[model samples]
Each structure stands twice: as structure tokens, then as C-alpha cells.
Target: MGYFVPVEPGVNLFVEDINQEGSKTIVFIHGWPLSHKQFEYQFNILPALGYRCIGIDWRGFGKSDKPISGYTYNRLADDIRMIVSTLQLDNFSLVGHSTGGAIAIRYMSRYSGYGVSKLVLIDAAAPTGFTKETAKDLLKETLNDRPKMMQGITDTFFFQYITSSFSDWFFQMGLEAAGWSTAAIIKLLRDEKLDADLPKIDKPTLIIHGIHDKVIPFAQAQELDQKIRNSQLVPFQYSGHGPFWEERDKVNQLLTQFI
Candidate 1:
């Protein structure tokens, strides 16, 4: 089943509550321009392995309500807090991919690991925000021509030899995301900073990154590891920005072991 947890009076966030008879839970948060559905590789597999899996479609993405505002990390973290409070989750794990990783970090910093136990960032945009001059210019370019920006992403970001079907899937996922949310998020990424929040996360943290990631540089993982004390970083040699999909087997193995 699913839950449309209310974030605001009229805004409800969609959460795919794949609850099973288990104590340890895993909440999967998707990356930019995608929804909980992006974690298709994790939800069912984790439950079968005796872990409860819940995937959240952040406000304005996936099946969640597309509100005009509240697209920043602070508000997104608050939305996550509402979900945890509503579900009464405890000793749970939060797994975030790409931009979702930043959101997860924000949540942990804000709540001090309220119901969260372990943290896993897969090919995440972390500790430091995308506030570089180059990123700013790219954001402006994306805002100017979204379709072209998306095409460029699919062509240059993913592993060089990805199949047509896989490329199409990624493109479709991007297209499915709301234009307003996408544009606002790009601007927010360029302006927001997460350096202070990094040290606040004291839980067991795992930083998984792909060496070939063209979207968010793999070097960011090193920076994240340095900031989050005792965090482990695993680099996928053959993957790109999406290790979960690019190197599914390895990503699954690492996730299963981490949890």
C-alpha cells in the first residue's frame, strides 16, 4: 500500500509503504527528476530479504502532490520528518540517491537521527552543494532549454555504452518530473550549501559513488567521507552517475551488506 502523508494543508507527499513483518526498515529516496519508482531494484528485493522498504516520492516529484513552492532542502527535510513522525518509524535506515542524498543529509542534521539509524548515500550529491560557477552556468543553461539539457544529460552522463531502452527509461523519468520542480531544484542546488550539516550526522554512514559519474563528480564522495567522520566510501569502477542502475548487482550486494 501507499500513503499520501500531508506535508502542508493541501500538499500530500506520496510514500510507497512496502511494509512487511519486520523491525528494521529502509526508506528509499529518489534522485532528481525521478520518484520512488526509481528504487524499483530495492523495494521488493529488500522486503524479501527480511527488511521493510518504504520509498518516498518527494513533494513535487513522482506521484506526490506538485506544490508550487517548498522545493528547498529545508522544506524537503521537514517533509521527511513528517513522514517519519506519521509512520512512527524507529531504528530505520535512510537511503538516498543523487540529490536525495543531500535531502537525507539535511534531514539527519535537522532531526539528529530521530527515527533514523543508518545512512546510505548512493551516487549522492552530498556534504557540499552544487554551488560552483560551472554548475551555476549549467543551471542557467538548463533553465533556458530543458529539452536540450536533458538530451545532453542522457548522452554524456550515463555509462558510454548504455542501451537504447535504458537511455529511454532515464529520459522518460526526467520528462515525468514536474518542470517547475526541476527548474527550482537546479537553482536551489546552485545556491544551497550543505557543509555545516555534514558534521551533524553521527550515525553509521556509507558513501557509495561511481568513478565515472559525470553529473556529480566522484571527488565529492571523498569530500563527503572526510566530513562525515567514520563514513565509508565505495567507488563503482564501471559505473556513472547511476550506479544503482549501471551496476545493479554490485550496488545491491553493497546495500544488502551495509544494512
Candidate 2:
């Protein structure tokens, strides 16, 4: 029971909350090369707790406009800042995964928790060792490309974290919905660092990571838990990068307690 709740169309924000009304809102921001639909489970479910769960498609991803510019972390955060203030939301909570988590941290650090009350990061990307060395290498190769993107990043995107059953979906269908280009992804992966802003968070944060997560690695979550003063870390032994999809029931239980 959802429809397109629109914004100014710069970054193309889409929002959904409670059917009738809700006191608290949960804003879920999806990861890189993935749309808000990656959180389709969270949007459809989680209402039993009477929560208004909303997910946003970042610039160049999801139903959002896939522009040729404004891909910087600051630009994306600015778009989200407008969305929250426009809705006039208060005491809101945020849940972000991987790249989404990095954006959340960046937003919180700069704005100092304007509307955000609680923060939950699932397999977040903290820029501790998100060194520019490896990225500089890959991006150098990406520079030889043309203006328009022609290939899918899914083929080798999650080569390390993907399994047989999970392979066909998260990268192929899910990433396609986001509409991210190879150049956009390369730039994004190459030129962003959230570690500089993490130590300044004042809000309560929950870091969820999978022990088997090869994408961002479990140590990244540990580093976040160590740095964030009011944060806790949860580890999923059998799960990979996407714990919510891997072990949903347990992930829900952890989220229930976190929020």
C-alpha cells in the first residue's frame, strides 16, 4: 500500500510512512548500486510495531533521477536534509546499510542530529581503511570509458560476498532497479570517506554486521563500535553482507531491541 511521495526532484527522493499515522518514523537508506526496494522487506513489514518506515533512493539510484552530476557525498546528504526538514519529522530514527550508513553518518555529523534520534547501521561502511589506493587504481581504468554507461556492475560487484541463491537477485535485479552507472559507481567508490566524521556522532547507534561479510568486512563494524561513543555492535555468525536478507528473523529481533 505505497505510492510515490515526491520531492524537489534534484536527487529524486521517495518517501513512505504509516498508513494512518505514526509518532515515530524509521528512515531506511539503501546501499550503493541498490534502490530503496532492497529494503522491500522492511517497508512491507515492521508496521506491526506501529512504525512509519520510509526508505529513500539516493541520487543515481532507485526511482530517484539518475543525473550525470551531483554525486558527491555532500550533495546526496543535502538532498536528504531537505527531505527530513520538508516532512517536518521529529524524533525520527534512521537505518542505513553499507554506503547508506556512510551517508547517514555524514549527515548526522554535519547536522548534529536535527530530526534523527536513533541510528542503526547494518554492515556499514566506515572509511578507516577505505583507502584511496585501491580505488585510485580501479578509477584510473574507469577513466578510459565513454560518457554514457553500457555495462552492469553486478557481474563482479559482489564477487566475494555472493552465493548461488543470493547471486541472481541482489546484484542483478536489485541493482538494476537502482539505475547506477559504472562511472557513477566508480566515482562513488573512489572519492568518499566517512571515517573523518564518525567520531562526532552524539546519537545512539547500532552497528550490525555479518561475520562472513566480505564486502565491507566485520572489522569495519568493530571499528565503528569502538569509535562511536553511544554505539553497540551485533554480529551475525552465519550471515554475509546482507544480514537482514540472510537471517531476517534474528535481524528483526536485534532491530526491535535497538530501536
Candidate 3:
């Protein structure tokens, strides 16, 4: 079922909940400039295996409310907290990709990993995101020619060959987000520090990262594995930044085994 859940006053987040009665539950948080739609493949497959999959679109992205503020990591993490509390979710697996992974990190630290049992970070942008100079250029590009910037992101998204239609669809997802939200997230990627948040995660973590990822380096995954106690690192050799899509079957297998 798909519905909007109010995270705060006048701000409702779009949530896609599948197999509501399944025994296991997994909450998926998407990357920057994208929404819950990023996990379409997972939703299609995971729910069939008796696992409930919940995908949430962050505010200002996807079908969620696009507010001008609340772009900070703390605010984003709080938004997630409200969702978990409202749904009464407990002992669920939390899967986050890219920026979503960073947000998950903040959630683990800020909320003490409330209802989460296991954590999965896919090519997560943690420990650090981007340098000041790169962030400045990205923000400027987003402001000036957002489409071009998104297209560039799509080009480097996957190492394997993706059809033109698939590429267009992925590119469109990025464009669906608000410009301010996109730029603000870029700033967050540059300034937000998750060094302190790493060691605080006590849940078993599965760090899946692409060896050829250009967006967030593979080293970041190594750092995360090292910092987070009781964590395992699984490298996706044939994928890039988007291992969920590039190596979907392997990712699904890993998730199945881990969860």
C-alpha cells in the first residue's frame, strides 16, 4: 500500500509499504536526489519472499512534501524517527543508500537505533562526503544547470551497461526533486560529519559498496566497516555507485543472507 504519513505539521512523507503482513520488515531509505522509487527492484522481489518492504521518500524529494527548510541531517533523521514511531516499527532492518546511509548513521546515533535490529549501508556516503571545492562546484552546477548535473550523475551511476530507457528513467527521478533540496543536500554532504556517529552503532551492519563507485569511494565503506563494531564489508566488484541496480541479484542475495 502507498500513502502519505505526516512526519510533522503539514509535511507528509510518501511511503510505499509492501507485504504488510510479512514476518520480516525492511525499511529502505534512498540516496540523494532520488526517492523511494530507487528501490523498485527490491520492492518487486523482496515482498514476494515474505518480507515486508517499506520505502520512504524524504521531504522535498519524490512524493514527499517539499518544504524550504529542514534539510539538515538532524532534521532529516528526526523525520525518520517520526515515521518509525508512528508505524510502531521494531526489530526491523534499516537499509540506506548513499545520502540515505548517512542519514541512517545519524538516526542510529541520534535515536540510539530505536527499532532497528540490523543495518545495511550501500555505497554509503559516511565518515565524510565531499570536499569544499567539489561541493561548491556541485551546488553552483545544480543552481545553474541542474539537468546537466543530474545527467552527469547518471552517466557515472552504474559501471555495467544500462539501457537508454533505463538511464532516462533514472535521470528523471533526480529531476523530480526540488532544486533547493538538491543543493542543500550537497551542502550537507560537504559539511555534515559522521565521524562520531560511527562507533555508536551497536547493531550488526552489512556494508555493501561497489569497487568501481566514483560518487562515494570504496574506502568510505572500509572506514565504516572498521569503525562500526560487528560490521562486515561486501564489495560489489562489477558495480559502481548503484549496486542495488547494477548488481541487483547479488545485492538481494546478500540482503537475504544477512537479514
Candidate 4:
């Protein structure tokens, strides 16, 4: 079942809660410029394997309501908290991709991971917020010319050997997000300090990162593993930033084993 779960008055997040009897819940958090659709692969297959999936599009992305503000990490984490509390979710795992991974880290740290059992970080933006000093220059350029910067990001980070249809779909999904919202979110990410949040995560964590990731480097995964005490790092040898799409079978197999 899917509904707009209220985060604040007049601000509700679109959440998809797929319930399955006798199955564990896995809440999926999508990355920036994308929606819950980012985890479509997992949602399609995980439930039949005795795992229910919950995917929520962050505010200003996907089908979620877009306010003029509130794109910061703390605010996003609170939104997730509202969903978990509203659904009475317990003993579940949180799987976050890209910026969603940073939000997951904030959620656990801010809320102390109240009902979470484990965490899965897939090519996530972690410990270090955006990972490059050059990102500051990019963000500046993005503020001036969003469309141009977005095209550069897509070309350099997103598509590699993927088909035309897949790449087109990615571009379409990104286009669904508002330009102002994208800028605000990027500003928050650029300014965020998550080093303290990393160690606060006291759950069994699995970090899966693509070795060839240019968006958020592969070294960040190693850094995350080092910070999170009880965490395992799994490198996707041939995959890039989008492992779930680039190496779906391998990622799914590894995820199943981890959980």
C-alpha cells in the first residue's frame, strides 16, 4: 500500500509500503535527483524471497511533495523517522543509495536507529559528505547553470555501458525533480558534516560500493567500513556508482547473503 505520509503540516512524503506476511521489512531510500523508482529492481524481486520492501521518495523528489525548503540531512532523516514511526516498523533493515545513504546515516544517528536491525549502503555517499573539494566548484557552477551541470553529472557518473533506454529513463527520472529543490539539496549535501554520524551507527552494516565509481570514490567505502565498527565492505569489481543497475545479479546475491 502507498500513501502520502505526513512529515509536517502540508508536507507529506510519498511512501510505498509493500506488506508480505511472514517476511522481514527492508526500507529502501533512493538517491538524489531520483525517486523510490531507483530501487525498482529490489522491490520487484525481494518480496517473493520473504522480504517486504518499503521505498520512500525523499521530499522534492519522485512523487513526494516539494516544499520551498527543508532539504537538509536532519530534516530528511526526520521524514524517514516519521515513516518508520507511523508504520510501527520494527526489526527492519534500511538500504540507502547515494545521498539516501547519507540520510540513512543521519537517521540512525539522530534517532539512534530505534527500530532498525541492519543497514545496507549501496554505492552510498557516506562519512565524507560529497568527497571532493572540486564538488564545491561544481556546486557553484550548478547554481549558475543547473541544466549544464546536470548533463555533465549524467555523462561522467551515471551511464557507461548501459543501453539507450536505461540512460534515457535515468534522465527522465532526474527531470521529474524540481531544479530549485535539486540546488537546495546539493547545497545541504555540500555543507553537511557526517563523520560523527558514522560512528553513531551501532548496527550490523553492509557497505557495497562500485570500484569504478567516479561520483563518490571507492575509497569512501573503505573509510566507512573503518568508521562503522561492525561493518563489512563488499567491492563491486566491474560496477560503477549504480551497482543495483550495473551489476544487479551480483548485488542481489551479495545483499541476500548479507541480510
Count of backbone collisions within predicted model 4: 0
* Residue-level lDDT tens digits of model 3 in 40-65: 98988999999999999999999999
lDDT string for model 4 (122-160, tens) is 888877656357567667766787667766666766434
Best by TM-score: 3
RMSD of 3: 0.7
Against the reference, the lDDT scores of all candidates come to 0.84, 0.70, 0.95, 0.84
- Ranking of all predicted structures according to lDDT, beginning with the best and ending with the worst: 3, 4, 1, 2
**Clash counts for the predictions, in order:** 0, 1, 0, 0
Candidate 4, superposed: residue stretches over 4 Å from native:
131-145, 158-160
TM-scores of the candidates are 0.93, 0.82, 0.99, 0.94
Let me know the TM-score candidate 1 reaches against the reference structure: 0.93
Off by over 4 Å in 3: none
Worst 10 residues of 2 by lDDT: 145-154
Clashes of 2: 1
- Candidate 1: segments with Cα more than 4 A from true spot: 131-144
> Residue 107: error of model 4 in Å?
0.7
Report the Cα lDDT for residue 7, model 2: 45
Residue pairs clashing, model 4 = none
